[model samples]
Target: MTESRPHALFCFGTLLDPRVQTALFGRTVPTEAATLAGHATRPLAVAGDSVTAAGGRDVRPTLARKLGATVEGGVLRLSDRELAAADDHEIDDHVRRRVTLASGETAWAHLDARPLRAAARIVIVGDSIAYGRCDPEGGWAGQFATAHIAADEHAHRVFNLAVPGSTLADVGEQTPALLPPRHPDTIVVAAGINDSAVPLAASDTGIDGLRDITGPLDALLATARRHHARLVVLGPLWLDESCTGDFEGLRFTAARALELRAALRTWCAEHHVDHLDLWEPLRDRPELFVDGLHPGTEGHKELYRYLSAHHC
Candidate 1:
């Protein structure tokens, strides 16, 4: 008798850790450092606020100074049992779904979406929050990956191409590289937090940073529409006051974050994009923060639950 080929799981977060993988899979599984095409990864950070990480200023404090090189991690492959364990671990916010790998192969993974009769290919584009910043096991995006279900289980896939500190400007330059050749059914825009943090003086043409924001947002929406994808715009979440210490230049109060949220809400309305506001419920809950900007375990779970329930 021949042994069965193990089920493959492409893990990009805490599960990339060998020890963590063992804990979840009951044994160390095969893994690799493969990049998912149409996505780039970067170090997660808190925007609109700050927090202490490694005893340094938390929010973009290393701007003038070189903090270090790039953040790195491995992608894991697991057996069916391990995948099930991962699903259970992430059960609070995600439902397991299928995805297409860079090599044009299909695999099962978690996705964030409400229960729907039709499964739509979802493309999430943004910075760290969409990249699964703070939560080591999985960020809200990861939870969303684990939670979304499709009308036809085999027909849908979700792609997350979020980069930490990725501003709208960066997305404009990188969209062609990050978007799949075939368009997705739905596109989620989770930007602006970084744009709000960038210095107002960076642009060469004397355009304000706000223009920098709108420029890319406009292009991104155009791209989505060209592909016939439904667009969903997500507003920024509130920043924990305690986390504000690290971000030197872009100091914003919770009220300011809410103000940004309101502005984004208006933007989405004008553009006809479906809007989801993340700040409304988290305004008072500092505990939801892992280090003030990033959501803790509970925070990830809550975000997933909220979005899943409200997804149309």
Candidate 2:
């Protein structure tokens, strides 16, 4: 597993209050005084303060992005769970972003989240399956993005953020930066194949990075979860053993696929995340696959049909 990334939070409002901190975090939070650039303090337009301020006063302060403006704040030292708790306390309406403090510490700052309530925004993060590489229609998520927008505009705004040849760890490391300032309503994760890949030169029934699988999946969805996106997970595809050798410098087998798929399925059930299993239905359909790894055009259509019908 990759070394855990240090997460620092910049607080400019009630989050700085010790009472509020304790209420949300269950203890006093240690912090470093800092300043943020391109933002300034402002009166909140919210209906009421989410948390009451010190001394039972109803006073509240908020921050807005402003040019040439700076907000004095402190960076809070927090565990990953603590940071997520802070996000939950903030109502999940703020888009927490990676920022550089004036003192040069990389931290997370809550910024304006222009919530799009009218249109649905979907973000797909995964490897080649999510990328829709072999499909002419650009894959299932691609079909969602372009199906109705060719002439008539569709209310659905789909962001296909999948990268070719990415493992969940690789994608998790990069996904947060790829998120737009505006929060997406839904984030779909289509990963797990590459993690189970074994070299074509050899064969192994064992999956090497089992720890990496679930850990990386959590990391992959962390940002979206903080942003309050509904999640849909597509499990690892079932491999075709008859054509499983010597593709993409990896030897993939039905056994490896089943093993990897089980890992993902169990993790999903444990986490209470919505998981769609493609293993059983597609296990017998080898004709749709160009390689044991990727689906052909018709296969892409099938993938789209299933994902669209089941995505909630």
After TM-score superposition, what is the CA distance of residue 45 in candidate 1 from its true location, in Å? 40
Candidate with top TM-score is: 2
- Clashing residue pairs in candidate 2 (N, C-alpha, C atoms within 3 angstroms): none
Report backbone clashes per prediction: 15, 0
- Cα-based lDDT at residue 262, candidate 2: 85
Name the TM-score of candidate 1: 0.57
Give TM per candidate: 0.57, 0.57
Tens-place lDDT digits, model 1, residues 29-52 = 667654334333323343333123
